[model samples]
Target: MALKFVRGQGDGQAESGEGQKADNTHSPDNKSKWLVNYKDRLYRLSYYTGVQLMRFGKRIRRHAVAAVLDAQDWLLEQSAETRERAAYARISLRRTLEQEFFSPVRAFRARVKELRAEYDSAKSQGGDQMESFLAATSQELWAETRKVLGITFNYVAPLGAAALLFVTITTVNSFSFGLKVEYNSKVVGYVRSEADFEVAQAEMKKRIIYEDYIQPEDAVPRFTMAIVNDKDIISTNDLTDRLIESSGNELQEAYGLYIDNQFMGATTDGDSLLENLNARLEEYSTGAKDEKVSFVKDVQVREGLYPLTSIVDLRNIESELDKDESEERIYTVQKGDAPTLIAQKYDMRYSDLKELNPEIETELFVGQEVLISRSVPFLGVQVTKTVTETEDIPYEIEQVTDNSYNEGFTKVSVKGQTGEKEVTSQITYVDGVETERIVLDSRVVKEPVTQKVIVGGNKPLSYIPTSGGTNNGGFIWPVGGNGGYVSCRIWGYSGHTGVDIASQPGTPIYAAAAGQVVTAQYWGGAYGHYVKISHGNGLYTLYAHNSKLYVNPGDYVEQGQLIAAMGRTGRATGNHCHFEIINNGRYLDPLQYVG
Candidate 1:
């Protein structure tokens, strides 16, 4: 079938032909101009289809806008619910765009163009009747248009599906993955990002085995380090080099770096770590080079022994006698006096009295006199003496004559019993017998009278018992008052010991009890002007920081005796007595024992 050119084809141009208008819509060779017609139809269909598609697109856009508005409304509602729900809603929108809109937009646009091309081709091809062809093309175009609409609808369906899916999944995940942070073995802290995770892994590899290098006995070394974030390693050598540069000392030889108990590194150039440590130790040493403590050896002393002399050395004595000897006096003893009593009354040494009265007899009779002089002239005096002797003798003799002839005639013959006695005399020499003796005559008058005697003794004396026993008890308060306010407790800072009590300045401080003053002085250190009194028991009472002390050392003070006046002397901050009671060398709570 020959298709005649009609009015220069639909594109409006001419092709080669005799008395025939040229068809310029396409090339001269008839290559099925359906593309041209299709293009035309596409243009027309696209115009109308675009009109319809634009209407549908507008409808779709409107629907999308409405869905977005709905989604936004839902999001706003979700936001109103709670902070956690609002976050979920935002994540839901991001997921929906990623999965549905971004993935399906390309396919939907391509399908619309395909449907328009098919409709244009059918329109360009002539049909049996114009109406029938128009109807068929219209039907075909409607079908394709419906297909495009279906594809668009299909593409858009997922957006809603994704929105729903994301909302559901995000709701669940919010419960599951809700901002959890945990420290893993690799990480030094909570890892929240990929960079943080990577840093943690790297740090794990650079693990410091601190226990390996650090010996248990090694002194814990100190270091100044520039700590790297998240890493525990220390740059000991670099630090030591810097220190050496700053201090102008050889630190590499003296110091080292340690981390987690491990000796990571040491400095090599300067003084060793040992030297630095030694210097520090010497600073705190009990003995130092400049201040040395040494023992002083005992020295033996030799003494020259000399012989004793009985002769008087009167060289210096002559001068002393000329100066004041004339004023010296000596007195003799009275009758009823002994040397001890005499020496005591005169307040002279007994030995000195004995030396002065060597010639005077210790046994003095009533009229006896002795020399009493200050000079050697008194020693030339002499004493007179007298002696006496006495003797006694006794004798007896007996004789009888016969008177038997007259004895019978008269019983008047008396029994003459004569006891013979003898008397003798002897002459003896005597030297100055000034003492006299009296002799009385001795004679017997009567013979004897005899009487009978009884020998038995009487009864034993009756025993009696007396009744009485004694018991005594007493107590006394050491301090004057019941108790006082606790100013300070048994606490110490630095080397200070004991507590302090606050009392008025110039208050008469009494001895806590009967005690000997161990220490009474103006102590200027921590305890101030302090006094320590030692009671016989282990207890000791300290009265510190006083204004005045009434008694000297070794003075025995009784309980409640005024020993000192309180004052803010020495280290005290105020005018108050600092009283402390120490027992067994340990400070006790004075409040417990004072009252």
Candidate 2:
């Protein structure tokens, strides 16, 4: 039989004429034929023998299976000369394809149109040199166009792209834009969201209240918010709280004070008010003051983040944030207790404490129970302020002495008159507690009148009763706390008529040597609320600046009996009792008899 190569057959195709039907069993290892069919690397149908002619021509100039039929028909109809010329054209085409390259892009339709237009223009001008130049240009353009077309249609390429982006180290990622806050050229904090920035700012304000103590408008720190990309980002976690704490710490110092389970405000100081007390406790525990001064009860000084007021104005702090966290506590008076001391121990004002307990005697008993409260502010900051103010200046009294009068008697030759003055003073206060003062300028508006007195210098020794020199044995100490400090000594200064004994308001006053309540009402003016008593003896004891009086005019109060409470009423700025021991309507220093 003659050897032949043949293409595989499709279903229902007639068998070849002189070939007998092969056996039904086909071998997978057959060199020329196989039973199975599959797709080849060219993505064409492949039999055991060869590949299918489903696609033809350049892979770049993709042609369908149907186009191959036309190509084959054209080839078959070409004469020898045409056929050979076509082959040469194909060779040149392949050379162009191999020489140049292009990315996947739009077809070079512009070049085709350009070439055509140029040809048309040259043809209209009718120049051989121009025509020849255009022909050459056309040939070059043809190749370029084919290259573009090749990439556009002959092959599938992925779209390549590029982009431009801006990044910076001063940015962060968040739902909203970033906010950067700077203070005195230093970056204090950053926030991603607007809400977080607000919170951060609010927290920062705590320092103003707690530390710098400046007005809100005087706050030097500032904030800035802007947009940023992810690449230039940092974190904003707990950012508000962190910034708040950071700023507050920078502004103010902190301390805590405690006393044998009780705290006293006697001699404590702080950068603000609280720290001094707390630090005193710390010092006492460490033996810095007096180690031998042991704790009367609980002997431990607790360390804790004692909350403080914010640096912003107290009014602002109270209004800006919620203070649902405040609590009220009650304290019982222990031995050696006074209203002022109790107020200081609980960190409350003497007047405020007295106001809280209006029913209690100004003087306190050892077992007396009083109500005191501690309110923890939101931010642990105390706002201090420097304020310029004009205040009333008390006129001075100048005394002129004459040696022409009798010994125990004096005459006012010229009456004294008060004057006015203009004073510019700088007052420093923390949370409304005055700490320091400076007088910037002062001018006396009205000159004060000096009192000329004819005094008994050495005239004669007058007969003075010796009976008024000693105590009647019925008096007792009235105010509490270290037995009441004689802040203003008896007639210690000019124009001071009586002794001002300092004590916390609400401290009790006793009936000096069993007296009758001659006057006990709201005595206005500098004495504030006061009480007067007639001892029934030739002498009388007057207790001015009493916050409350338990006795009526006709009521008899025994020695050491609680008759009134100490207070800062009328013209008084603080809690103290102005006491006087008088005989025959003559005022004398109470200390003389009390001592």
Candidate 3:
């Protein structure tokens, strides 16, 4: 390549063209678009008011094309007379003019010639030249324009390409259509815009409350806010409702407590109803001592089936929550359970349970239902019924005078016996409580046997009854140990005049009853140590064969006082006590008085 310079007014030209560079940026196809657009305009205008202007432009373009070609031929003629670089510059300029301007104009003229032939051919065959008073439809006009312009491609391809190009360019700049609200990593709802997401997020925040590190019984529900994340679209209204419902426990599982089979109130725990019921009724049973009955809501509180307490249900619940009365619950009669116990369990009076269940008949069986309520139905009712029970009967005693009997000596001919009598009464109950009892009938169920006694009516004044002293003439054991055996009662092989009691050698003998010591002696011809006491009216108690005598001759002795110790002495062969009970010097069996 060679460079050429042009003289400038600011300084003398010297190698100026060396720094200059030619611009060759355009392609032929890109240049052809301008001619193509201009031709399309002319083709359309030739049928309308610009038809003459379009024809004049074509004639002027022909003359301009001829002038440009002759100028190129003159440049060739001048090139032979110019310097080598100048000659080259002129040739490059001519070629650039041909491609940039002359070629497009020549192609346009040739296209017009071809379209004229085609239009003339179609007119000879009576095709539409569109010269009628009625104008062609837009579809027919576009078809004629394409045909005259000799366009080989779709006319709207540029617009379609521009639209597709715009979409492709904008794809990287896209934002989400809406925001998705997530809970535990699951999509719950959507927000349409940044503003909608903000609003929804705020609404979710309001539903949330803090609950952490709290006790189970005291831990109330605390809802968490829903989080918005980038995701697909959803209905804002419908999902918001479900989210709110999840956050609130207004609808909850609970059991309804029914009284007399009627709805009363609802509680989350059935046991709570029972507890409240028992607490309320505790004072009504007279301290309700030993209440063994239990109460529970009869209705089951299971999911999917149990009553879900809603706001409306809560309305009804709170309506009666403060009321003292509970729904009537039926209690079963367990073993050892009474109507009174049931009443106490339900905080009711015993009469209340009785009145509600008349069939109880004063007896309850296993698995029996006792209606528990404030159901003391009647204002008043009276119940009259007969009751039968046994009573003890007395035995009559008779004493017969016998002059032949010794003083203070008597015997029971026949022993007395107590008997029984059956008595029947009528009981009256008002309001299930006992009010009155009246005897209706009586009869002796067993006969009593009278007792007979032979008394010594001819006894002197000095004689005393064998049964003397206090405690009905009873006496303590004369020895240290309780009675095991009396060796002899009377005149056995040893000719014992009184009873002989076997004992340890040194066992002490006590006085039989309260009396004075008539004698206390360790010396006697046949008897060893001996003590005798004379009770009032000539009654005498004697103890013999003792190792020692404790009472003096005139000392007073009480019942159970030690009088003597036992020993084998004098006529006794072994350690034994000779005890004697006599009234007015007449011996009597000691067993009759002491035992």
- Candidate with the greatest TM-score versus the true structure: 2
Ranking by TM-score: 2, 3, 1
The C-alpha local distance difference test score for the whole of candidate 1 amounts to: 0.41
For residue 264, model 2's alpha carbon misses the true position, in angstroms, by 34
Q: Please, what are the lDDT tens digits per residue for candidate 1 over residues 1-595?
A: 1111111011112212311221121122334344334433544543465468658868899899999999887767664457677678889998886666554455555755775575566557655444454665566556755766675677778998999998996664333111111221111222112222222222211221211221112111111112133233212222222222332222122222222222223233223333432342243334422332111111111111111111123332223223421334655556666455566777877656555565232233345443332443210111122222232322221112234332111121233233332222221211111112232333344332221112111321111111222111011222233333446666644444555656565667788666556578765344556677755335677877687888754455666787887776655555556777665777654545543
Q: Which stretches of candidate 2 lie over 4 Å from their true place?
A: 1-321, 324-326, 332-336, 340-373, 379-389, 423-444, 457-459, 462-595
Model 3 residue runs over 4 Å out of place are: 1-472, 493-495
**Decreasing lDDT order of the candidates:** 3, 2, 1
Largest lDDT belongs to which candidate? 3
Clashes of 1: 21
Task: Return the lDDT, model 1, position 492.
Answer: 47
How many residue pairs in model 2 have overlapping backbones?
A: 33
Provide the TM-score for each candidate, comma-separated.
0.20, 0.26, 0.22
Q: Estimate the TM-score for candidate 3.
A: 0.22
